[model samples]
Target chain A: DVKVTQSSRYLVKRTGEKVFLECVQDMDHENMFWYRQDPGLGLRLIYFSYDVKMKEKGDIPEGYSVSREKKERFSLILESASTNQTSMYLCATPGAGGSYGYTFGSGTRLTVV
Target chain B: SQQGEEDPQALSIQEGENATMNCSYKTSINNLQWYRQNSGRGLVHLILIRSNEREKHSGRLRVTLDTSKKSSSLLITASRAADTASYFCAPESGSQGNLIFGKGTKLSVKP
Candidate 1:
């Protein structure tokens, strides 16, 4: 089965600290996405990359940035963590074939205190 | 602002009963998809319904699409406790193929 592995399952960081969330997909998919899931607002895309070194902002991109130095890995960065940034972060990729469906990482729940 | 807005923000049902969730989208779409997320976990793709297809089924899950209404529904027959999760819909529009989601329907199947 295809897998998207997240570097951390849970994290706690102090406000104003720089934080990094990592995701690695076994499939060599060119497309990858990062989203933050909240209680009622649902999942909002922060950024997505269709190729290495290429990225685009989604609906909500404020306070977040991404890195795609490699094809199989994508990373999300918080310039300076804030209390409002505490949420579950999910990394996703299209299925084996692009656009058929999606495979998502287990998610990293970040808590900025 | 997002496509595929779901209603009935929450639902409660018994183990042997069926659970139905609805999603509606605006503008044209290439396809629509449904997903399930367990508590504090990433989403799992449940089913996908293309624009031309009216209905599709997989295992105990049935999905229907009405492009004219720009809406879709997901029915889970004989839902189990394990089926309790948050269900979301994503409507893909344009060639970008990026997904946008609204508040999901949280289903709780009681034993």
Candidate 2:
């Protein structure tokens, strides 16, 4: 089975602290995405990368940034964490064989105080 | 704003009963997909139905799409307690494969 692994399952950070969330996929997919899921707003894409060293902003990329230094890994960065930035962060990649659908990793729930 | 909207924010049903959820979208889409997320977990892709396909099935799950109405429905037959989770519908933008997801329907199956 294809797997996307998130480095952290839960995190707590002080307001104004810099934070990093990491993800790695083993399927050799060309695409990776980062999203933040909130109660009523659903999952909003923060950023997505279709190739190493290339990234694109998504619908809700204002407070977040991403890096794809390697083909199998993508990272999300919060320059200065705030209360409103606390949410469940998800990482996903398209299934193998050029499918448009995705396989997601277990999420990282971040809590900023 | 998201492109899709789902009905019945929450639903509860007994095990072995069927559960249904609906989603509506505002614009043209290349395909519609259904996903399930367990509490505190990432989403799992359940099914995908292209705009041209009216219906599709996998295991006990059935999905129907109506392009004219810009809506779709997902049905889970003989649901189990394990099936309790939040279900989301995503419509892929015609140009890019990027998906806009709807607020999910949380379903609870009691044993």
Candidate 3:
């Protein structure tokens, strides 16, 4: 079975503090994505990387940034956390072609207080 | 704004019954995928149907796509209590490889 792992399942950070969320996939997929899931909004893509050092902004990329230094790892960063940024963060990896579905991590629930 | 919207935000059904959730999208799509998420966890892929295809099925899950209408429906037959979860539909557009998701439908299965 393919596995996607997140560094943390729950996190709490002070407002204005820098926050980092890590994701790793054992499948070595070429595509990785970052998304924030809210109660009524579902999941909105923040950023995605198709390859190492190559990233693209998604629908909601204003307050978040991402890093993909390795093929199996992707990281999401919050330059300065805010109360509004508190939500469930999810990371996913897609198989080589567009034919297969994505495998997602367990997700990180972040609280900005 | 969300590219897709799911109807009947919530549904309650008894075990051994069928549950249907609908999703409507705003634009053309290469493919539409359905996923299920348990409480406080990540999503699990359910099925995917291309724009050229009309229907697809996996296990007890059946998915139907209507490109002309830009809508899709997911039906879970003889659902069990374990099937209680949130269901979301995502549309993949063009070659960007990014999926635009719907708000999702929360289903509650009563035993």
List TM-scores for all candidates, in order: 0.97, 0.95, 0.95
Which is better, 1 or 3, measured by lDDT? 1
Clashes of each: 0, 0, 0
Candidate 2 per-residue lDDT over residues A16-101, each given as its tens digit: 99999999999888889999999888998899998999999988898788989899999999999999999999999877633337
A-chain TM-score per prediction? 0.96, 0.95, 0.94
- Model 1 per-residue lDDT at A19: 98
Identify the candidate with maximal DockQ: 3
Residue B61 of model 2, lDDT score: 96
For candidate 3, write residues A4-25 as lDDT tens digits. Answer: 9999999999999999999999
Candidate 3 residue runs with Cα over 4 Å from true position: none
Please, what are the lDDT tens digits per residue for candidate 3 over residues B42-91? 99988889999999989999999999999999999999999999999988
Q: 1 or 2, which is superior by DockQ?
A: 1
Q: Each model's fnat?
A: 0.78, 0.73, 0.73
Pull out the clashing pairs in model 3.
none
Per-prediction DockQ scores? 0.75, 0.69, 0.77
Better of 1 and 2 by TM-score: 1
lDDT by residue for model 2 (B39-106), tens: 99999999989888999999999999999999999999999999999999988865557777778999
